[model samples]
Structures are given as C-alpha cells and as structure tokens.
Target: MPLIRVESLTKIYSSTKEGFAGIREVSFEVNEGEVVGVIGRSGCGKTTLLRCIAGFESSDSGKILLDGKSVSRPGPDRFMIFQGLDQLFPWLSLRGNLIFAMKTVNKDANMKELQRKAEYYLELVGLSEWGDCYPYQLSGGMKQRAFLARALSVNPRLLLLDEPFGSLDALGRKAMQDLLLRLWGKTGTTIILVTHDIDECIRLSDRILVFTKGTLKFNLINPLPRPRMSEDPAYMDFYGKISRILEKDANLKWANAVLR
Candidate 1:
C-alpha cells in the first residue's frame, strides 16, 4: 500500500503582491520506503505542495492520507527538514538536540536507549565526533547533517526535505547527497524531497514529479541504475529529456502570460 496518498490537493492564497497564489489540484502517492522528488522552477508551488503534505499549511480542498489514515495536522510520524541551517537549536549540542526530539515523541523512552540511538544516528551521518559540538560551531553542511540525524532519531515513518542542500557549495552538496543515500539505505524511511535541482532529483529520487503553474505536469520513474553518474551518456540523456520538459512548460507559461 502507498505510505502517502495526496488526492486532488489544492491551496490558494490571496495577496496584493501575488494574487491567487498556491497549488491547485495537485495529487500523487509515495510508496513505503520510496524516494520521490518534486521539482520545478521558483513560484511554481513546489514548496506549497510540500508544506501541505507536512501539515504546515492547510489545503483549500482534497485529502492527504498516511499509512491508510487521514492526516489533518502535523504529527511525529512525519518530520520536515528545511533549507535553512537555523532549524537546529543553538543552545543545545548536536547530541542534545537528537535526544530532545526523541523524547518529544517517545516520552517514556529510556535515556540510555535514546542516547544509544542518538549516537548511532550521529555515526551514520558521519557526525559522531561532533555530537558534543554546538550548532553555531559547525559548518553549514555539518549543521544539515545534524538536522538530518535529529530528524531520523525520532524514528519518523516519512521524511520531508525541502532543498536541504541548497545552501551548500557544489562539493558539499555532493557529499550530502551521498550521505543521504547511505542514511536512506540504513533506515528505509520513505522520503519526499522538494528541490529545484534537476540533476539532484534524478540522482536521488526513485520517481520524479514535475510541477508547473501550481499543477503536476509529469510523474515519471527514474530508469537509471543505482550509483548514477552524470558523466554517463544514459544519465545525460535522461537529464536532457527532463530539462526539455521543464523548458517547454516554462515557455508555454510565458506565452500564455503574453497572450493575456
């Protein structure tokens, strides 16, 4: 069964600057343990769809189901990691933050077990040595890793990532992508990643959902094999196809606006 099912989800915002903003009739499903990537240009409601799924924003219409149950509000079963590194608590050390998150959901969990799990996830994210370090003391990439660890420590059934690596440098982004793959392999947690990077989406996602003008334009499965290398001809070919689709959609929107 699908772990997450978003049916005819719609949201609209009224504002003086950008009138009638938000997603419309968006729908998709995320299978258990599947990695789905949502991609589009800015102002395309990619993040809106993600926020709706995370329960951070209420949709004007439709439904979101998780594990066969309706999701009307935020819960421990779903955890979100945003693009900003400031999501971490500055006063708390990395390990402390993880422990605190664990306690929030599993209040009766034993301290020793929580600490053990914290350490395990820290090690998994390659931050074992920095567990005692404060968030302010770490680099941006390290801070993101800590955030990922903290989110995983809660044992969430679904992980929501919104351009989690967008702030990092090229090298840092690549490293985090590999780190994310390793962690996903270890945890088998279902993930919905919203990103503007097409190559990044192709590299990490099992399926890619293309959003344009507040609607789903395409839902496609990644046909490339594991350990996808951009240099490969097949990988480049697939990337070109996706890029063309995005470009075509953008042109169509521009033409429509001009006609109006």
Candidate 2:
C-alpha cells in the first residue's frame, strides 16, 4: 500500500483578491521508502502541497491519507525541514534542540535514550562534535544539518523538506546534498522534497513531480542510476528535457497573463 495518498487536494486562500487556490485538485501517492521531489517556480503551490500533507494547512477539498488514516493535524508521524536555518532555537545547543523535539512527541521516552538517539543522528549528519554548540555558533550549513538531525531523531514515518538547502552557498549546498544522500541511505526514510533546484531534484529523487500554476504538469521517473554525475550524457539529456518543459510552461503563463 502507498505510504501517503493525497486525493484531489485543493486549498484556496480566500484572503486573496481573486481567491487563489494554492493547490488545485492535486493528487499523488508516495510509496514506502520512496524519495519524491517536487519542482516548480515560486508561488506554484509546491510548498502548499507539502504543508497539506504535513497537516499544517487544511485542504478546502480532498483528503490526505497516511497509512490508510486521514491526516487532520500536524503529528509526529511527519516532520518538516523548511528552507531557513533559523529553525533551531538560538538558546539551545544542537543536542538540546534534538532531544527536546524527540521528547515533545514521545513524552514517555527516557531522557537518556533520547540523548543517545540525538547523538546518533548528529553524528550521522557529521555534526557529532558540534552537539554542544549553539545555533548562533554554527555556519549556515551546520545549522541546516542540525535541523536535519533533529527532524530525523524522531524517526518520522515521512519527512517533508521545503527547499532545505536553498539558502546556502554553492559549496554549502553541495555538501548538504551529499550529506542528505548518505543519511537517506542509512535511514531509508520516505521523503517528499520540494525544491527549485532541478539538478538537486534529479540527483536525489526516485520520482519527480513538476508543478505549474497550482497544478501537476508532469510526473517522471528518474532513469539515472545512483551516484549520478552531471557530465553523463543521460543526465544532461534528462536535464534538458525538464528545462524545456519548465521554459514552455513559463512562456505559456506569460502569454495567458498578457491576454488577461
């Protein structure tokens, strides 16, 4: 059975002048242990979809089912890592932040056991030595890594990521991508990643979903093998195809706006 099933999901913001539908009748399923990437331009409803699945946003119509149960509110079963590095508390050390998250969801968990899990996840993200460091003391990349560790420490059934590496420098982004791959390999966590970076999506996703104007435009499987290289002919070909699709969509959107 699919781990997550989003059926005809629609979320409209009435606050907007024209009542914008952030996501319009979107439907998709994510299988267990699958890494799905959502790619789209800004304001295209990628993040809205993730929020609906995470139960942070209520859908105007449609349903989100996880493990055959309807998702109604934010729960420990799903954890999100947003774009900002400010997710971590400045007053708390890295380890403390992770431990607190774990305890928040699993109140019956022993403090010592939570600490052990926190340390393990910290080391998994290559932040073992920085556990005692505050969020302010870490670099942007380090702060992101800590957030990832905290999210993973709870062993969530589904991980939702919204452009988690979008704010980093080129080098920092690359490092975080590699770190994420390694961590995913170890944890086998089902993930839904929303990103503007096409290369990053292709590199990390088992399947890619393209969104345009609050609608799903394409659903493509990644034919490339693991440890994908940019120089590979197949990789470049797939990249061009996706780029062209996005370009075409952009042009269409511009033309429609001009006509209106």
- Writing each residue's lDDT as its tens digit, candidate 2 over 55-126 gives 888899999999999997999999988766389888889999999999899899998898889989999988
lDDT of 1 by residue, 135-225 (tens): 9899888998998999999989999999999999999999999999999998999999989899899999999999887889899999999
Error of 2 at 15 (Å): 10
lDDT of 2 at 192: 96
- Looking at model 1, residue 66 earns an lDDT score of 94
**Alpha carbon lDDT at 107, candidate 2:** 92
Model 1 off-target regions past 4 Å?
15-20, 251-260
The lDDT of each candidate is 0.90, 0.90
Lowest-lDDT window of 10 residues in candidate 2? Answer: 12-21
Off by over 4 Å in 2: 14-21, 251-260
